[model samples]
Target: MSRTGIATGPNALRGIVMMCLGMACLAINDAFAKYLTDVYSPVQILFLRNLIALPFAVIIAVRLGGWDAMRTRRPGLHLLRGTLWLAAATLFFTGLRYLGLAEATVLIFAAPVIITGISALFLGETVGWRRWSAVLVGLVGVIVVVRPGGDAFQAASLFPLATAFLYAILMISSRWVPAEESLWTTMVFQVLAAGALAGLASLWFWTPVALSDLWLFIGIALAGTLGMTLITEAFRFSEAAVVAPFDYTALIWATLLGYLIWNETPDAMTWLGAAIIIGSGIFIILREARPG
Candidate 1:
């Protein structure tokens, strides 16, 4: 997902397909993460994943262009993004330990709606009445999904919702980041910074992983780089308002993977809530895309 510029040519359409593929890969990654957690510490998993992924991120950046192209005016912003992303990953993974993958993911999607408000108040981006209404409606849909304070609510479900604001803030900063900064540089910084921190944290309770788990780490690295690139390209070529709704693709993939791999079937209430959230999200995107 090269964020060089708004992609053009036949490749633009291809980006959309790649984006979907990326979502599928991400679903696979999450499934694998959940499986590994059963046998390994989540901190161990996070540390190794970043260490394995750092080289790939650097290589991708170099392949995209030289190290010189990776230069950024705001290393601070990238550092901040890396730190928050670590928190987001750790929190979401912890939530996954207790919540269904699809459910946690749906909650994270709340970031888009959060971004809308952030853009309006902080970035001074104009919000038309339609988008404002969409934001409100999107919140209603999230409420339908979470149903907080009720016995039906899953307490662990709130973790992703809490972490999502961090993810949203990271993404918002990414938008303002210097365009010249190679995606690879940003990615490299992310992996290295987070890996180092997680490694330090894991020192208190490091568990030895089996050889086969090391192989899984390799796969995690590659899948993460590819998924991140594809998703970045997706946003570059397509409007965020248009492309965001397609994120529901992850839920379908997650649900299928969860059922087959983990034997965890989402209940009827889960399905209904997901449908409301996804359907309303797509509707919001469509309304925003309409020509005014």
Candidate 2:
């Protein structure tokens, strides 16, 4: 390990370790969220998760940049981004109530693929025919996974796919947010906005929490914090291209967790569809990496 506590190496081995651990943490977060879904509303989960994290976000900002660290040049953008984040979180957890964790995770990964098209349309960025073709193939993989016309398909699967689009918008806004804005500012706005919105929305179907479920709530908060911290650092240390495809590692972690914790084994078709989505996603990444 390096002095920073994260390992340092140009080798794929170390990268794989970091990537797998990061994804495992994220999968654990999702698993906890799914379990809580049976009892808690999306807003409740969001409130508790961020309430546990909000103080730390403030502390981090103060430690790193003092009071000024929380400053933002664009309140409107912050509100807009927080809305997207809230929408993504709500839809994703709502989807979880009906879909398996692994299935939902794969569908959400479609966000980046959608982002390519969004950028082409809105940002005037050029997406060549080749990349556009890859996007179509990726959508086909999604259709296979969702299998809309088939009995295997659940209506809830669409929620995750829709959330993916919201996430893409969140990411696009993040890309445009002023660079001078501190991470603390961004984190604060996101947690506060999502937490408050979810809490209010959950009022319609709120349930009393048992003492035991409270324990799980603690785990959700801690694990979520850890997972998001790792993901943020992953972006800092590695190139986006290098770290992006590593997100597919979530499928592996979700599969294992689904088996061990929930005993939910995805059928053959799910695995096959996951493989196609991942393979096509990697192909898109590689295409971006190559010289024009």
Best lDDT goes to which candidate?
Answer: 2
Candidate 2 segments whose C-alpha is farther than 4 A from its true place: 1-16, 63-67, 290-292
Residue range 1-292, candidate 2, lDDT tens digits: 4443334367434455566677888788889989999888887887888878777777766775678777878878877887788788878989989888889988987887888889899899899998898888888888889998899989999999999999988888888778887776787778777777667776886788889888788788777766766666666666556666888989988888888888888888877778777877887776776655
Model 1: per-residue Cα lDDT over 156-214, one tens digit each: 88788878788889878888777777666677777777888789888986888898788
Note the Cα lDDT for every prediction shown.
Answer: 0.77, 0.80
Clashes counted in candidate 1 amount to: 3
The TM-score that candidate 1 achieves is 0.88
User: Per-candidate TM vs. native?
Assistant: 0.88, 0.90
Model 1: lDDT of residue 88: 84
Clashes of each: 3, 1
* lDDT of candidate 2 at residue 188, scale 0 to 100: 76
Q: Name the regions of candidate 1 deviating beyond 4 angstroms.
A: 1-9, 236-242, 283-292
